[model samples]
Target: MKSLYAATCALALALPAAAAELETYLEFEKAMPPGNLAIGPDGRMFMSVHEFYGPELRVVEVMPDGSTKPYPTEDWARAPQDDADGLNGVLGLRADRDGILWMLDGQGENQTGRIVGWDTKTETLHAIHYIGAPVARPTSFLNDLAVDRDHGAIYISDTGDGQNSAIIVVDLETGRARRVLEGSQYTIPEDTPMVIDGREITLGGNPAKIGINPITVDPTNTWVYFAPMTASAMYRIPTAALLDESLSDADLEAQVERYGDKPISDGSTVDTGGNVYITAMTDNALGVTKPDGSYEVLFQSDDELPWPDGFSIGADGYVYATINELHRSPALNNGEDASKGIYKIVRFKSLADAVSGR
Candidate 1:
């Protein structure tokens, strides 16, 4: 028998240096681009197509044989491009151990936010709730989310779409959402210009402030970890403290701990052993952090992983992510859809274990 730490070490040694070459898992037509990756318990992979604009297929499940079908239903994905209800579509997804597919949705036009849960096992729409008003303001990006099943709560990060940032906590059982750490350093973005492939990333002719993009919870569900796209360090807070709305803003801020210095990351996930896997935006690779808060490069990024946007651990222990090719989009490239290549979904050997609180 082997210990979890020893297994992780052996798996790391099995990976190649300078980053192992990644294989293309799936490709999408330009009309329907990729958003995020979510692997379910049975090895079924789900992806959220770009939100809003009422995409033909907003949420599609990637079959093991290399085909895709609209998840739940196509009608369920008809996100109103004009702002009737922003919650109609999904931009992020996570399949929990309970066999439920949780989706993170936002109205790009109005910055409205919503979360929906679909019971994959029973094939039923489980729950749906909207994030409105104070918690989710007009500028909220509602970028990503992570579930804490222990207390029946879900934490959402508002990227501020460049203007601000905050974490929105919702009680799944009660349908109550609370805004925490608003405008704090943890949620604020430096908007540092990112240079990938010698091309500076610019959106709307200015540096993009994609704050609080990635959020993940640890195995015991004790801490909820998070980071901004333009970031210096990843932060974590006690899950119990985050759920207590009675805590003052100052008190909650005090609970935040600088887990460690990290690179600009778009997505992050944690294995059961407490190893944190994050997208290495600077070197275009996969980076991991130990439980002690030490960081190291796992695999260098390449191919369809140009912009690794979302991450999830598969049932087989592989880490999966999506190649958004975001920097080339017309929305950021002055209306010129300059995607260097085709969009795709990719995965790599995480070597650790499945995500926490799953």
Candidate 2:
């Protein structure tokens, strides 16, 4: 959704176009196109591949030198739906302050999912929390997750393949995962349509709309925020309400609050200072929302960041994003491979730096 005329003017004045800039951090010439990113406390960058053209590693660590290596072990990245190997599709990743790398791994065919906890210090996967049939159905599509280390819990957004969507929460201590607010208003997308560069997104000549996609937890872990891919409004529910198994589905859904609105965003991440940075794909720009709910256009370049899909914020106050040049793929152009290996992981200064005269 376009901003109000007055807000647009204020944002333009706040962030001068001349200062809007990004650096080419890493370029992928191979087929391992990235989907999302998470930066460790010590500054190591980990990314998810989300099943590329043929078969590639699902998770990798970006070395300081810019080379990529499969994380944990290559066996986990092995091709051919290895249930024994313990991972099918990795869509989201977040490294909490306690040195734990949390992942949302979903198996679409079986409609099964698991929230995994990888101990970066020990270099091993210490936990595998699964979502069973009653919660995650054949239609459920678990897209991304937000980690709440303060309460030892993790929240995931299940943006189903079709129209249905829901939120799933897991308790680390007992490894119990439950589906809350299934098919609720907060989880499903409204009537808003998705169009980029004056073209609609379609798969097999049908309009493709994604729901309940991007999710992020506030730095303080007070609330969990999520928004649909095709909707403008962002909603949040109290972290306590989500972790409270005593609450009924109706009671938990009642806690959802419409914090505000945002442009169509793909990926989101929150900094230690509590500012939320999101990739606004529609405007071909990056947006930053302050604590008070006001947002600004940090930058909107035409040539670069055409499809800012995911983000990872570094301790040095820089945010890294993967520009999958062709966002929704060549099928958006009638079944031709328009993407010519032009994928890049770009970095820009912090949101505060981008808006201020830094």
Candidate 3:
């Protein structure tokens, strides 16, 4: 039997540049994909698919040669009996130090939202936390998640449309979860309407509204930064404030500071220097916010970089993102899905240099 580490080592090689002008990587064939990306500690790339009805999860491994291989499994869907109608899709994925793959289950159509962990060593699945019933709206769409392994906690964004929108903090050790920020103020709706390709659009065919969607935490477990999928303002709060039960709601709210006025950002990640890399969907560019509260466009691709969904800062100093054409589909406010591909921007320095001023 081959180990996951061995499998990864056997495939390590230099991937040929896909494009000369831009750093082109392999494009995994996907259909209507959602939150689908996870980078292993060994520098291997993995992505999943979110097809509407069937074949919910399609896992793919990107080799160093810029080639791709798909995991032979259509059984990634694990729907509980309670939410039989909901669809099982892998949204946010994180491989902890133990090689366990933690996934955020965004039960799309069927509406059952939960978090599960896949132990590759044991080849088993375990439900770490379940979100449903009285605490949160059953239809609440749990989007992305960021884990603080040092403190054993996970912060998730509940981007519930109309029904509910809030940030959920889960205690990994205790299996307890709480809804910290809720309603329009904290989970405020976007003021400027979402205009894609000269037309207004909304995700899931509903009216375009602001809700907290994608989130990313700093490497030191100090801050968790997030923004609404359609909002222009970026907000964040200290992990200490969020994890502390003694902090009053007003105190926690006061700690939530506006990071900056950003474009339509779907996903974000911070480097070691506390610089936040945000996928600005509206401007079709990748924006970077330094530690000094200043933001700038790191890289800009023509309209081809549409609807950038997730962010993964590679050890090699390249920032990767998934460009899902969510606004293009009619179900998402009648937008068009063009230039949908995974993209990476490489810094002219090593990961350490990118973090520290070389």
Candidate 4:
């Protein structure tokens, strides 16, 4: 006899055109700490645990019935307490073309960050690259990364403390990195202020300034889209221009294109069709930009999504997001602790259809 959870998941996955439905799949009891998420080809979810103390990374296998088995592996959980100089824990999870999971360890404040790859089959950990200063700012918060599997190059965003935000490019094969756009027009924050909860929030303590947060590459791997958390506008730079070593700063600056105004978005991902989905923290919604340059509210859930952070689109087309209440937490702003949780806007395409059709 199949369990109820399994039956529900079976029916959900069986529905071919059901991708557009707006639904809440799961929620954690306590607030989910800051983190990043990656969905493997097999549908298993890998998520990072961002906090002072907890499993540095966790793997959850969603059963056929929708129940989750959280098996925290030793290789992913081990922290170097003694070597406090190095990156201690994982912040972002991304799976490369070979089906191996890559974890971005943002060594906290003073330490150099590192990217570690885990073999899911053997549970072995391998250090692919260590991202540090001179090329990247010492205070660089290597927040998120996108990989070009074909070229073996990875692009990382350095959300510095202030106007020093930059984008660092790394050659996976050579283990060498270079800062492509530092203090460039596209790398800086926009001039528009972000109004959240009826009060304006400043970027790096400056009003109406731009501070780069999360970035995502288009499905075609042609463009990289980025936005500052404090600004509503989004911008993009062609991958050709960014990856070209010969392109002058002025030449690269002229190619930047302003995508348009979006909600206070944190993490972003693009589907196979070139539709970009952004986790809009302020609006409590997922903002969708279609290929035709039109924007629409794909889904909005005030109760389901609060301070939605990094998210990834599963091969099945489902978009999962982490709802971290950074704004609600007093530690960040006013000493208020807004509990965080992980939530998924299941059947995103179906929900997009339902919302737009209405």
Best by TM-score: 2
1 or 3, greater by TM-score: 1
lDDT of 2: 0.76
Stretches off by above 4 angstroms in model 1 are 1-21, 29-32, 52-55, 80-87, 108-111, 161-163, 301-304, 353-358
| Tens digit of per-residue lDDT, candidate 3, span 139-230 | 57777888888888889888877336888898888878898777647575656777767767655565576588868888788899987777
Q: Tell me each candidate's TM-score.
A: 0.87, 0.87, 0.80, 0.80
How many angstroms is residue 224 displaced in model 4 relative to the true structure, after the best TM-score fit? 2.1
Model 1 TM-score, 2 decimals: 0.87
Q: List runs of model 4 lying over 4 Å from the truth.
A: 1-20, 52-72, 83-87, 199-210, 340-347, 350-358
- How accurate locally is residue 50 in candidate 2, as Cα lDDT from 0 to 100? 51
Please report, in order, the local distance difference test score of every candidate based on alpha carbons: 0.75, 0.76, 0.65, 0.64
Q: How accurate locally is residue 262 in candidate 4, as Cα lDDT from 0 to 100?
A: 71
lDDT at position 314, candidate 2: 78
- RMSD, one per candidate, in order: 4.1, 4.9, 9.2, 8.1
Residue-wise C-alpha lDDT for candidate 4, range 1-358, written one tens digit per residue: 4698897676545433334456555554442354677777777676665542253334443444544444335433645566532236666677765777777777566567777776765656645688877876766777778877666777887777547788888787888988866776666666655565665654334453446767888667788887666556677888887778898878877888877667667788776655667778778777766555666676677776666777777665567766665455443454345454443324354333323332
Comparing 1 with 4 on lDDT, the higher-scoring candidate is 1
Choose 2 or 3, whichever is better by TM-score. 2
Highest lDDT scorer: 2
Cα error of candidate 1 at position 88, Å: 4.0
Report the Cα lDDT for residue 91, model 4: 60
